[model samples]
Every structure is written in structure tokens, then in C-alpha cells.
Target: MNDFLLYEKTGGVVILTMNRPEQRNALSSVEICEEFEDRCRSIERDPSVNALIITGAGPVFCAGGDIKKMRDRSGFAPAKTVIDTRDSYRNSIHRIPKALYNLEVPTIAAVNGAAIGAGLDLACMCDMRISATHAVFAESFIKLGIVPGDGGAWFLPRIVGYSMACEMALTGVQIDAEEARRIGLVSRVVDGAALMEQALELARRIDAMPGRTLRLTKRLLRDSGQLSLDHHLEMAGAFQTISHETEDHREALAAVFEKRAPSFSNR
Candidate 1:
């Protein structure tokens, strides 16, 4: 709905492109945050959407927060008082991670260029990341004399491990795509020209599965990180029961025996 972000849905795969090349796709304001949150909600409600790929429109993925807005005390920057600033963060930027974390479908970040500060955290929030050869990343909040107030501490450590997260955060150093892949920050790195094609190819492969099953699988994977093995087993059993009863499951089995392509109703 907004020019800052472009939403394109093809069959069951959704691609959200941060469309502010002039501003380097900055996470500039609360309005932009709301746009992301709203689109996430829309994807969750749409049964046909099996996967999501987020990328930037132009050269840079995102520049993090807007320095101009920060200096002027506008957008999601400091407010008139300490209490208001805290409330602002909770009300504005925090919505992104919450919305993304709770989304049912699988999500991927296609890092075409630089992803810094909040931008890096945004990529970390996704289920997977694919980076271009020229991509750059930095947990640069410390460089700005601040910390990641938008849940970077939690997500970054989960993606890149505690020690590496500390190195990135404390040092505010940038890493290239190859280094990101070496540290497992990104799953794959391709040429910048082929980034979207590869990302969409992966997404389409994911979309070929039964929709309900895909969502359930993603839910189990996300929950397993925070859950005890025993608890996860119980939850997995419940999810399996749901999957077992679906029409798609029957079709999948029938196709295997018949040696034919399965057509799913996504039930």
C-alpha cells in the first residue's frame, strides 16, 4: 500500500521489496514499520501464501535507521522524555520483530547489498537468508552510540551464535557476503544479478509443498529452538496428528505409490 515497500504475490510466494533506493531503503520511520507489520499480517491471513522473500529494490538492502531523523528527534528517534522514548520503541519499531516472529509461513531474506544495524537484525529475524556476492552486513548500533533496541541482541545471537554476535555488536565491524556465509549468517551467496532469481527459485520449491504442512513444519522448527526436547516432541506429535488427517497427506502418499505428481488442495 505504500511506495516505501513493494508487495508482489505470485501464486503462493510473496516477495516484499524495500523500495526506497534514494534513502537506501532505510528503516526510516514508524510508518515504514507499520507497513511491514501490516504486510506480515496479510500474508498470515492468506492461505495461499506459502513463502515470503524480503529484499531491497536497489543496491543497498537497508541502511538501518535514518540518521537525519535521529538528529532531528523525529520518526522513531528519541522523544521529548525518557518514558516517551521507551513507549515509542515498544509501539513503533518493536512491531516488526513481533509480527515477523509470529508469522506462520517460512520467510527468507535476499541480501542484495548492505544490511546494517536494525537492517541486519531484520535479516536475522527471517527463517533463512541468501546473500549476493557483494552483500555487506554490520551490527552497527554500537557505532551510533546506542544498542539494538529492536530485538537485535536476541535474534542476532540466535542466528550467528553468541560469541560472533558479540564480536559484531561490540566491534561494529562490517562483514562481506563470504564472511557472512562462513559464519552461517547467510545460507548461500550468489552473484547480485542472480540474487532474486535464486531466492525466488528457493521460494517456489517451498511453495510446491502442501500449504498447511509447510506452515506446520515452519511452526515446529521455530518453536523447537525455545522448547525442551520432551516438550517439542509432544508438540511435534500434535502437529503430526494434524498433518496425518489432512487430504494432502493422503494425496502425497498416493502419488508416491502411483509415481505421479501430487496436486494439493492445501487442506
Candidate 2:
């Protein structure tokens, strides 16, 4: 929308780029929060946009919050200020994790470089992730003498297990792309220059899929987190019912029977 953030729709993909290259594309200032949310909401509202890819300009993805701003705000230390800051982080830039959780379309994070603190949290929100081999992830909040305020605490443990999350949070250690792939933090990693190439390639392949199934499957996965195995199996049956009834499913079945490639309408 503005220089701070930009969105471009191409085919079934919506690319949301963080535009603060001078600041490593960090979402530090409060000015762009509303704009950021509005753009993301627009993406959600578009049924034609089947996937969302978040990345930054320049080399680095983000370096987390503005340290100078944090230090300046620390002098007050009132409970209300602390609460408001936390809320601001969530409502503004850090809510991607939560919003992506409920998004009807799949989301991906193309990590071009360092993703520290809130940047890492943003990655964890994506349905899948691709990163440059030169990219790194850092649980850097502890280095600033604080805990993971947004979705980092929840996402890290689920992604890499509790022990790893604890170690990463407490020590603020940075994990390279290989380690991230090993620990399941990322789906794929490639050369720095090839990061977006890989992400776009993958996005294109997935965008050609049955859109309604992907959306419902994403919703089911999110719901499975809170349900028991038996209950989830029951839920799976319910989800499948919806999936099989889509017009896309009918087309796919007919195509298979006719020995032709399925032309999906994503109905």
C-alpha cells in the first residue's frame, strides 16, 4: 500500500513484501500497523488469492523491533504501557501468526535472510516455509531481557519441541537454514539468491491444486490441535464430506475416469 508495505496480486498468489529495506524491512514503527493489517485483510477477502507469500526487500527479512524505540519507552514502566505495547505488537505486526492460523488460504514465508525475534514468529505462522541457505532464525527476545510476547512461545515449541524451544529462547542462539530444515522449522532451503525462486515455484505448484480442499484442510489441521485423536478422526470425516462435495472434486473424478488432467475450478 505504502513504502512500508506493498501487496501485488499475480494469478492465484498474493505477494506481500515488507518495504523497509533501509531498516532490513523491520516492522518497528507503529505507523504502518493499520496499513499492514488492512492489506492482509484484503488478501483474506479475495477468494481468487489462494496463497500468500511474505518476504522482505533487500537481503535481510527483519531484525525485530526497533531497539532504540524499546529503550526510549522503557523509562515509564507502567503496567498499562507494558500491556499496551504487548497489545500493539499483536494487533500490529506480530499478529500474523494468529491471523494466518485462521486464514482460509495457505500462507508461506520466504525467508531471504535473518529472521530474528518477531521475524521468526512471522515465519512460524506460515503454513509452510522456504528460506535461503544464508538465512537464519533467532529467538532473540531473551537477549533483550524479555520473553516471547507474540506467538513465538507457542509456535517454537510445537515446531521444534519444548526442549529446543526452551534452549533457543533462553540462549538466543541463531539457527542456520540447514538446522532449521533439520528441526522442521523450514520446509526447504536454497541459495540466498534462489530463495524466492523456490518459494514461487512451490507456490505455483500448490496454487494449481483444488483451492477448497486446501482451505478446508488447513482449517481442519488447526482444529485438530485442540481435539482428541478420536474426536479429530470424527472431525476429519466431517471435513472430508465437505471436501468431496465441492465441484472441483466432481471435475477431478470425471477427469480421472476420462484419463485426462483435471481442470479444477476450486468450487
Query: Which portions of model 2 miss their true places by more than 4 Å?
Result: 1-3, 74-94
Task: Estimate, for each residue in 131-238, the C-alpha lDDT of model 2 and write its tens digit.
Answer: 898999999999889877767898888888999999899999999999999988998989988877888888888788898887878888778778999999998998
Q: Write the per-residue lDDT of candidate 1 for residues 6-109, one digit (tens) a residue.
A: 98999899999999999999998788888988999999999999999999988999889999999889877576898888999998999999999999999999
State TM-scores per candidate. Answer: 0.98, 0.92
Candidate lDDT scores, in order, read: 0.94, 0.81
Distance (Å) between predicted and true CA of 184, model 1? 0.2
The CA-based lDDT of model 1 is what? 0.94
- In model 2, pairs of residues that clash are none
Q: Name the TM-score of candidate 2.
A: 0.92
